[model samples]
Target: MIEQKVIINLTDENSNNLGTLTVSSIDCKNCNESRVRISNSLELINIPVVDSADNLTPIQYCPDIGANFANLMFLEETEYQILFESSDACASYDVLYSLTKLNENYFKQFRFSLGDNKTYKIAGTLNFRSYVGKSFLDIRKNKINSIKIPIEVRSKKMDYFNQYSSMIADLSHHALSLIFEVNSPLYQEFELDSKEKKTYYEDFMFLEYLFRNENLPSIFEYLSKNIHSQLKNRTEQVPLSLASNFNQNSLKNIVSKPNNLYKYDADFEIVHKLKGHIPQMIEQTKHDDTIDIPENRFVKYFFESIRDLIEKLLLSSDEGYIKDKLLFFSNEIEYYLSSNFFKQISPMDYVPFNSQILQKKEGYREIFKYFLMMEFSFRLSWDEINNQFKGFEKKLSELYEYWCYFRLLKVLNDLSITKVDFDDVFKVKKDNWSVSIKKGENSVKKFKFILYDNEIEVELFYNLRFSKNSKYESYSLAFKPDYTLLVKIGEHINYIHFDAKYRSELEIADYYNVFGKSDKKLNEEIDKRDSLEEKESIFKDGDIYKMHTYKDSILKTEGAYVLYPGNKTEQFFESDMIIPSVGAFSLTPGNDGVDENNLENFIREVLKTLLFKHGLINLNWKSLDK
Candidate 1:
């Protein structure tokens, strides 16, 4: 008999059950029947035969599992073949409509519980296909609407997710990965809109962190570190041909000058454009603008002394020692800049790449403050502060030239040790989408930065390093997830890793295996990292947060999500969240929240670096208080 315990008996013909037998079933190969619906029925007889009025037992109650039974889960009509009739065999099978598969990549699964049923037949299995290829995020197609006009053109927005497990991931990584795993394919076979494709592009940038999805882990190397945070992948496309159809010249124009394509610049674009200029010019200009800043003299002097620091770092340490020093500088500078800022400047002022101010800290501070305050007053006096502030302004900005070099240095450092894979392919209308990935005539300001020390020699070294060793198609796949947060509730803690989720659900075996585990299982993986760094960095504090991405809704499952940093969010998300933010990095920056590429090795390196240099950078990247 088939049951919650196990299937015991199988026979090719129903007549073989002369009386009744209960045996354990283990081998499928030896079974003679193609498939059989075994029954485990417990009987209730008439001891007194009563209705509720008198409290007597009913007559002959041998119940068959009905709709209220596990029957609803078994959409296959023949699932209750024996209960329906012994000789009934339908010519075709019923489309097991409501059966939902788990939202996974390689380990895709479909399941329905025996909610109230007792007996059910195993139906035929369907071949594998992508849900991304089948659904759309339609506002008009309400849940009440049905595609009854089957003969008419049948189109759909992809189902970004596969199932409705009550988990609303809070971290960007978990959220992005969910969407990434759930995103459906946009193919030439379907007739989709230009806007939809544009939405896809925008989502790709924010969620998957990839501007283009022609291939997995595509090189977005030419993009700037500044633009990395806010480069919107908002390109619209109507499919005409495959990727080859994308005008290379158009792309070149797109990369060289994205400003020409858009209607207006948001905070992100302004930063990207300003940073695109020569590092020297950009920083000098920024410095001049911030002359009135409280620590102006200190900052300027720091900039002046940047060269020595770079030399010290370069000479004192080669490839191995640079990471910690870099992290220290990256953290210290960012904290100092963001924390101490009296006023918010343009996006250009927030570049994370800059040289270290290694020596004579006090003198540098004095010089910087004097020049900064003096410049502030000078700029304020002018009616308009455009081209009028050239000459000395340019020279002042020259002090910051080293940041460009540092930005390049970071990119090269990223490239030198990291390995990424783009085995997967995404087919969609080709369009020009760009970022600071450092490819296709990408520029410094476009992919540049501003160091706190603001030194030229350091800038020069970074510039030379990147210009020489780095590819223009700079590893676009390198996504710096806005943040990695850890949240705790009830019995478990969730590590929310954020990244971009570009494509919908494909084949993700590992993702399913990891996310599907219970609380006990999740802790095991955390404790058993292959490296101490991964163990400490990833599990103890936090790691690169690649948010899970999704395809809104599709067949089988309604809303599905997959986490890139499939740590522990799987345990509590929807089960607790009454309403959750679907936006990527909703907890931090770039909150679009869905798409999918977070490099595996890149994640490891992030954890390793973060743990190795705990004191170097200041961040809340730590594990939940479990």
Candidate 2:
């Protein structure tokens, strides 16, 4: 095994050394160069491994170190300079250093000269102010030696994994529950043991069900109370004189064969046939109570299966918060496993059928039903979504968009907006009956809202695309908004556009400077900016500009809004007209509950304005009569 010493020095913005990390390289083949054949085209591509030392020296790249390698940890929104030094570097080698953000596909390469004309040393500054995840750093010295190191970036404000995961969980639960309630054909053909085509969605849904139903605790409690036991029969060799129920068989065996008889306490006995037995013995039948029933075995099997699944998920997960969350779940599962009841029961190879005990017993019945329903419940995948968006490495941008859509739907539903049908939103594929929700402009959901005896129709669109090629296109350039809402009353129509921004902050002036302010007042405010300390802004200015474009270009657009995970909401109006407005609303996933009051209120206000403007509701009415 070829071993190499690698030293990494981490420094902050002030050039103060934060810490140092020492990493060791492991040996592997094809480390210098490798060929990869594309699966689709079957075309071979030669990938040259950049080496930092001699061209003849083999490189030892460690790709199996996992996503969140402990050797490299960084805090979000922090700037740090990293210096890489390797003992195997040659004096004449020129180093090429590359850094790539795997999630965003951002790459930067730098060339380094020999450090002090002695060893190969490369340094770079990484600014993790925008996003957080795993990034790869590749150091190569011509054809000599190359090493790839994995870096983990983490958020300093909140638990990134838990927050995003919670959002996705809530959104998926709502969507999947709707699918289940409507009896989608996705659940028709269920196979329990077909593990080849499973996704993380299935794993999450199963875990959610178990936690939501409190199945584990309930099963434990029920088994503790109504402990099930069964009579087990066993046969043992004993003295023929002492055998109680060994009537005909024992007596015939002892009397027919004289050699079988032996001297006993006071009577003749059968001779022992095996070691560790009395001198003369006979077969005896014995009955005893055992808790190792099939039902108990099933319980053990369920717990062990769930524990293994959780452990697998933990290993595969790259997010620290998710690993911690999974650890908590694993601990909860261990509570059931450590119980004496389960310890006494043996493991089961196959799931048992629903027998009388499984069906009739209170505790056993519920768990058994859950076990049977597990495969059917989560087997369906989101067929319309891309495969990349289905697993743990799901894009937060796409997830936030979906979460915003579902959250808006929930808000509308909470406000008494009745959906027309699920036909457009949910469809079953003809090939496999897998459920798919139509995305983009092809999918539209209609709802009806009645206020003051006026029936108003509303349409919701997810990822609505406006194309210049269309005959009825309103925008000069093609654009796709995350969500679009259309309200219709008689001949009047209004369109409201919303874009989900996964940012946690936005740049904005005070209310007076942004809304209902003249150009002169804004100019005066800008002039005084030098004296006023500016607030740190993480939101992109282009997002606000995009909202303006949506409002200005899209015909009949009453409002264009940005939904972000922030704590403040701001709205900007065009002149004095409420119809032409641009704004951003705070719509974030809450640790306790969803923080959507601002968005909800804004949506309600929009509906009220539309109803009032269309003469559907009385102007004097303070609120809609629910």
Candidate 3:
């Protein structure tokens, strides 16, 4: 082991005169443990560790020290380091030198052997304070063999710059107010008025047009259309046998003698009338290929006359208006072949043959239409109307749309408006195709359909087993549908499909044929693409049919209806089915054309069918009448 005998001989060379150090150690310490015993004491003196082959042991760095540490001492083994440190110490004397404590209780009593004659020379200018937990100490000679053992210090405080920067920011705030030179990189993220921002699909009409002409980009494109067609087709195919009831025209006339036909409520009028006069028109059993319903006299006649027209209105036209409105929504333009659509489907005419006051009120139509005409006149930039008429136009628009649902109610009234004679309006017999299951009453895993908010979420981490082709990307985002269905008629579970669409349009090209030539993404949207069969086949197959079926069912279903803030109802081709104006539902039930009671009944039936326990009974659900 290398022994260090350090002696501090003070001669008072400079100021800040502190203390001295002396060493008396040749003690036979253990060879293995990292320790050294020393016998000498000094104030304002430091003994530090340095790096060198012969100077220190243990090559790893240790950082645990502070500046201004007192009673400083370094135990040198030259092999192992067992540095035991205590500070704020009292002192004792060596054989000749008097010692005073410096830091902790870290002083020495072991003698220097020279009992009375000791001379140490240390300069007063060097104020040597100690530190700990450092890798190495630097020794620099200062003139006469006196050296400075540099101590590596741990920082005492952080936040030296923050205190100064705050003052500058305060001054800037007072001087510039809101008109400061915004020079920060974060300034590019300026806030925008979210209400004024354009919608993601502001040009949704263009997408609608493109979708009608071009084939879709996925396997589920036609599913919705096919589903709608199937449903409508099945509805049209229903047998039209009249119910068992007496004719009500004469009864209506008899009741009208008091000018109170509008409020007429005859639950048993037909039965009362037929007791003696029309006995043959009482009971007649009818049979179709699949059904058996009794024919009522009055109900039969009432429906028989308009059954064809109602069915034509219901089943014939592909497009339809909400009761009386001019708003239209359809898959194909051919379905839009009715009246002038939104422009002509005035909302003032359908005042219920009952609100005779509103019906008899003739100029009401002009008043109602004048404001809408003027507003639209100004909006579409047709004939320039004076801005002074703005207030009148707004008021008329309000009364016409509020007090009278001209376009809406009329379209609903105009719906293949058939009156089915029920045994009881509230109680229809259970001839349902299948049992209705409420949520949790049935198994979620066994559902025929599933809808999720994130199609990508399901495909990733969830590990859904579906392959991607040229037509649709594996991680493509699907529609955020309002509802999901799980129908299981027959063993058609193999018809598993989904409908995923974007509100935005993507002009997808034939990746199959054109991809072979260049293998790049095509930019433009083509109207007709007979040019790409194999690529388009993905979207044209039975899979797509299944998906579209589910999609269309959800789209047209009562709960999953589409809505907008500015939509309007219109008569496109037929009756009330086309009445999905901006914020209301349409009434177009299956088999029997929709009527007053049918709306409620259809809702209850759909709620049951949808398996949702929460039905739409209490909801002040706005109807096409709105």
Weakest ten-residue segment in model 2 by summed lDDT: 51-60
**2 or 3, which is superior by lDDT?**
2
Task: Give the per-residue lDDT digits (tens) of candidate 1, residues 350-451.
Answer: 212222321223333233333332222111111111221221111111111221222222333343333211111111222422111121122122112122
In model 1, what is the error at residue 139, expressed in angstroms? 24
lDDT against true structure, model 1: 0.23
Please, what are the lDDT tens digits per residue for candidate 3 over residues 63-107?
Answer: 232221212233221111111111212323121111121222123
lDDT of 2: 0.58
Off by over 4 Å in 1: 1-91, 94-120, 123-453, 456-626
Candidate-wise lDDT, in order? 0.23, 0.58, 0.23
Query: Model 1 residue 512 lDDT?
Result: 45
RMSD of candidate 1 to the truth, in angstroms, is 30.8
> Each prediction's TM-score against the native?
0.19, 0.63, 0.14
| Per-model RMSD to reference | 30.8, 13.3, 40.1
